[model samples]
Target: MRILLDSFVSFFRNNYMQLAAALAYYGMFALLPFLLLTALLLGKSITSSQEALEGLHRLTYQMVPEFQAVIFNELISLSRLSDTWGWVGIVSCLSCIFPLVVTIRNVFLTVFSAQRKRPVMIEILRDFSTTIFLIVLLIFLVISQIIYDELIIRFFMAISFPLYIVDFMVNLTISTVGMTVFYYAFIPVKVGLKHICVGAVLTSVLWAVINPTLVFLLKLNPKFGIAFGSLKTVFLIFMWVYFSFCVIVFGAEFIAQWDRRKEWGILSTKHGKNGVKETSPPLERDPPSLTP
Candidate 1:
């Protein structure tokens, strides 16, 4: 327990929290164009573009209920304007997603460092692929929700079971898997599977708890929406992304802390060889060893 507490302290002392805050700012900047381009692509894949549009709307509203009207209205406008945006416009928006993706890659590398930095082109390719991965993941989630509603519910009803429980479990499992994929793929370094799995599950649970509580609290101030008016959704979107970035970065930092502590023999397991993987990067200066 002491070791765990110290790990968190180290995480703060290292100023990873500040890094997370920077990520939130950049993430908010990226979200608008990224989502716009994503929705455009998703619309192309589906039978109806409107359905794709609504899926994004529904997912956003579920996460941040306070901005339901705002998201819905903005999405509607975007949908209408989608036709006006030419290939050049679409390509331009997508190019803008590169910086956010690259920033995220750098953050992950900084948090869970490798022996040395990889090539810049390789990093760029990885980050660009990550952008596509996220859009595909979102589409899969939307489709999964549709499947659960249209088909899975019927199976549970036939067995006389409360399906909402099933729905919750399924959603939770999917969220965990999605988070695990992000941590595993984005970090650009080797970490123990145990650490990655724990980080993913912790992030999912933390997000589940924080997002709803935030929604409720934000709803208490109804004046925010009226005051911001049409811009309410934009503000709320930034808030949601910002908080989420903080949670995810904290989780990564916590896992990195655990790795550091483990290497120094601070948090030893009873078993002769614990499952966590350890790395001994050759630091140019003194190592990042914690003081007694």
Candidate 2:
């Protein structure tokens, strides 16, 4: 309980909400480009562009059902735009995702309190590497989902198993694993898999709750977005992104706080301070102090 409370307090004290809001803003700008890049890369594989689009659409729907159509339509538009721009468009799309990745990396460093000591060139290369890694990971997950849906899902249905249970479990496992990788990759601190897995599980569970709660709220109040007029969709999408970042930031904080518990006497501290002494006095100190 004390650890949880400290994490919560540290979350706000560290200005995590502001960090989340910043991520949401960058994410909005990067969304279309990231999707376009994904489709373009997947086009080189066995998957047809249309199939890729469908897979991306399904992923988006599962993530934010309320705003999936808006996102999908934009992805379609970007695909058309890419046809004329050629390599330049692809390069631009690739570049656009960097800012978001960099923001995420910085956010992780901040949450974990990892210092930035690497050279600028190294940092840029790392950012680029992380971007490509994440993009590839996204494509991999999408393709895997496509295969799983066609194969595993069919088999389950043929066996008369409950589809919802299968879906929920599959999604939960995927979410947890993906988040675990994300937390490990982004955090500048060298964290153990156990700590990250715990944080990832927490994040995945909270993230799973988000979509259903949003869907239920929208269903219960279909006109809830009307107050925003024409920008209702945009507003909702931004809020969804913001909420996601909040969960991510909180998970990172949880991991940091959990690591702190390993320090000797940390749990016994009343104010959550490190109770271990930096340097202990010698057990047999000379009496030279009295002579002096």
Candidate 3:
């Protein structure tokens, strides 16, 4: 119990500042994209004249009574915007790269806080490349999803049960892959693909368990309710950004601990004097004179 308490204290002491900075940085980048995406999605409903969109909006309003007006107004505005600006919007989205660099550097430093020096450019480059790859992979996954929706939906409708299972497995597999990619990309530690796979699976399970609870709590926050009324979803968006940072930090620590345990044996036994029983230091018999 003492060890557990110590660990928790250590985590907060070591990570709180970096976590806060990273969250703030990422939150700023996330806000525009998040709002734009929400708008586009809602606009799609209007374009298709889908009653389901209204139902979803209503449900969201009910769940987050405080933010209903804000969310609704944003969605309405986004729907009105011309699609031609999407390319320009995407180009501007690159602004996220700067803060992402800072956040990634901080995450790397946090993971290797025991190291003597800060990460160098080469180290940063490697992490950046891997992150880019992961982003590309995620894009591919999105494209795959689009294809499924466009071409496979009709075929799958005929065998919905089997298709449902396949889709679930595919999503799980992709999520695990994405997590593993991120673990290797961001953490400065060496982890095998197999270990990453294991960590990813564990992360997925944890996320599945925690996500719904988090959503429920976020909806319950009265401040979010107020912000939604004012056409500003900033508070809720910031909360999610911070929540994401916490999850990433927790996942990194979990994977690091797992790797350390495997490599160095149980954490409890990894740091004692080499096979020797611990004892109090011998008392000096006499005070020694200082000599050059």
Candidate 4:
């Protein structure tokens, strides 16, 4: 616990500024259009069916009233806009995907320093792979949510409860996988699957708990709540990004600890052999040689 606390302190003292800037660069670009596109999509579904829209609106209101208002308004406006304009909105939404991915890659490079450990070519290749993986993951998540809304929600209302849990778990799993991939790809040390799984599980659980608690805290504090308004949206996004970095760093420590344990095991085996030699009965020295 002391070590963990020290590490956490070190993260803020060392990497907080960089993390903040990275999030600022990435969050601003990612959040607005992402939310807009999502709103547009939700709006389309809602226009097609009012009951669905109300259900979504209700969910959004519960989570983020202000941002939901913005999204709901945008969705309503987008629905009224011409088909050509709607297509444009869709394209605009899709356009942010690559930039968001690239921003993440840049942030990873800045934070992880994995590039320094591996060959430049290997690092770049790994980075590219990570980017592709994240992009695919994002798409899968969006599609999954859409499918959930369109299909699952229709048949089972109870599904919402499990769906929320699933959402948290899937996101946590992805975050862990992404971090593990980055660690192995860039870091000089090799990490095992067990280590990676440990990191992933820890990160996921941390995120699952931290996310909602942060939201609640933000909602409760007036200074943070209304003064920033949707700007808190930006801060919330930044906080999540920072938390993720913290998790990655924690995972790195876990990997480091694992490696150290292995090294200790090897060293202990050698030490035991040397200790046996020292402890064994000394061979009888021939005193006759000195007398002769």
Candidate 5:
């Protein structure tokens, strides 16, 4: 109990949320182009280009149902356009996503502030490696969405159950595993799987909740659209990214600090602070030099 309280205090004291906000801001820049590139890549491979486009469309709405109209409009525009920009957009998206990946790496490093330091070049290489990992994971996620989850869920839909439950379960598992891998791989410092698990579990819960919670909020208050106007979906996405990273940073902080809470006398009642429990202070030595 004491440890948990101190962890929250230390969490805010370090300004982890602000770092997440920056990651969110940069992540938003990467998301649109990355999604477009997925559609472009898949379209070229499949027998039906139209089928690829539809797959991207279905995936987007399943992730964020409240903004289906917006996603559809943009996807339609992407499909109707020539291939010239589609190729260029892929390159541009990679550039944006690289920096976002760099930021994510920084977030993990920042959380484990007291861990042993790596050489600058090694750290840079680690960041680049993790960035590649991130890109590959995303490609897999998009492909899986198109090929597996959507198909299986649709096959089951005839049996009865809202589409949202299927969507939630599929996404929940994927997001959790991704987060666990990200923390374990990207954090430059040596850390145990147990520590990584703690953060990953926390992040997965929050990430899973954000989408459905946003839908419920918008439904309860249709006025959110009025406030944001044409940018409603965009704003919501940005907020979603911000909160997602915030949760991730928080979990990392927990693992980093959990062992040190004892130093602050916050790990147990044996420290005898604030009447939580009473225990004797450490034994003290008597002075001998003064009498001599």
Candidate 6:
């Protein structure tokens, strides 16, 4: 109870939503460069353009279901020019990924760290490393999802379970596992897996539920983004990305609170001031004392 309360309090106090908004803004800007970089990599590895496009479509739709068509089209357009980009353009695109990664590192530091700042060079190096880590992790996630869709889903379909439900469950599980590993690896503080798993699962579930709801809302009201005029797609995408960052930051706050409780000795099971264990035994070996 105390942990939950503290988590909420710290969440609002930290202004996590505002931070998420900032992150979303940067993320929006970074998207093009990241996609271009990805396209360059894909162009080198995938000999067939059509197969690469299909893979990108699948990966994009899997990651961000909302406004995927817009993103997919953009990816297709950018991929065509990927092969033409020289070293200058390639370096330029790679440089754009750093700001977003730096922002993420700062956000995590704010939530999970209390130490003073480091040198600029050290910070830059760490940010570079984190950027590489995230990019690699994303590639791994894409591969994992592809494998699941290609093989695991086929096996499950043989059992007669609905495809939609199975996909959702698989996505939820993968998202949970991904977020858990992300928090564990990304946070500046040393934390146990048990401490981060709860927040990761909660974030994954919320994300899963909200995604379908957003799609449903859009389907129900075709003019939901009518007010945004021609920029409706961009507006919707930014809003969705913003919401995603908010959920992610909230999960970080929850994990921090869990770690905080342990630091304050509230979650300790060792002997207390009176030499009695703070936590109860697994099995009750003694009757309750009638005398309070």
Q: Judging by TM-score against the true structure, name the best candidate.
A: 2
- Whole-model lDDT, model 4: 0.52
Cα TM-score per model = 0.77, 0.85, 0.60, 0.54, 0.71, 0.84
Give lDDT tens digits, candidate 1, residues 218-270. 76876665667888667677777777887788777767766665665543443
lDDT of 6 by residue, 1-292 (tens): 7666666677676567777887898889877677657657655644355555555566677557877788867766766665677899877766888887777767777777544278978877877877767666666666676678678889988998889888888878888988987887678888888988998998898787777887898889978777889998888888888888888888887887777667657545445655775652121112211110
Model 2, poorest ten-residue lDDT window?
Answer: 283-292
Model 4, residue 68: distance off in Å is: 6.8
- Model 5 bad stretches (over 4 Å): 1-7, 43-65, 79-82, 85-89, 114-125, 154-167, 225-229, 258-292
lDDT of candidates 1 onward, in order: 0.67, 0.76, 0.52, 0.52, 0.64, 0.73
Task: For model 1, name the residue pairs that clash.
Answer: none
Could you give the candidate ranking by TM-score, starting with the highest? 2, 6, 1, 5, 3, 4
Query: What is candidate 2's CA lDDT for residue 22?
Result: 86
Q: Candidate 5 residues 196-277, lDDT tens each?
A: 7766776677666766787788789877756878887788778766776777777676666654443334434644554566
As for model 3, its CA RMSD to the true structure in angstroms is 10.1
In order of listing, the candidates' clash counts read 0, 0, 4, 0, 0, 0
The stretch of ten residues in a row with the least summed lDDT in candidate 5 is 283-292
Candidate 2 residue lDDT tens string, 1-292: 7666777887776667888888888888887787768876776442335556667887787667788898878777766654465777877877888888888887776666565699989999998999888888788777867776778799999999999999888888877888898888898877779989999998889898987898888889888878899998888888888888888888988887777555424445533455543432111211111100
The deviation in Å at residue 160 for candidate 2 is 0.7
Report residue 211 deviation for candidate 3 (angstroms): 3.0
Expressed as tens digits, the lDDT of each residue in 34-141 for candidate 4 is 544544554445456655455546434433433567656665665555355556666665565445554554444443333346687875566556544544443444
How many pairs in model 4 have backbone atoms within 3 A of each other, for residues 3 or more apart or on separate chains, i.e. clashes? 0
Q: Candidate 3: misplaced stretches above 4 Å?
A: 1-21, 30-92, 114-131, 150-156, 162-169, 218-232, 266-274, 277-292
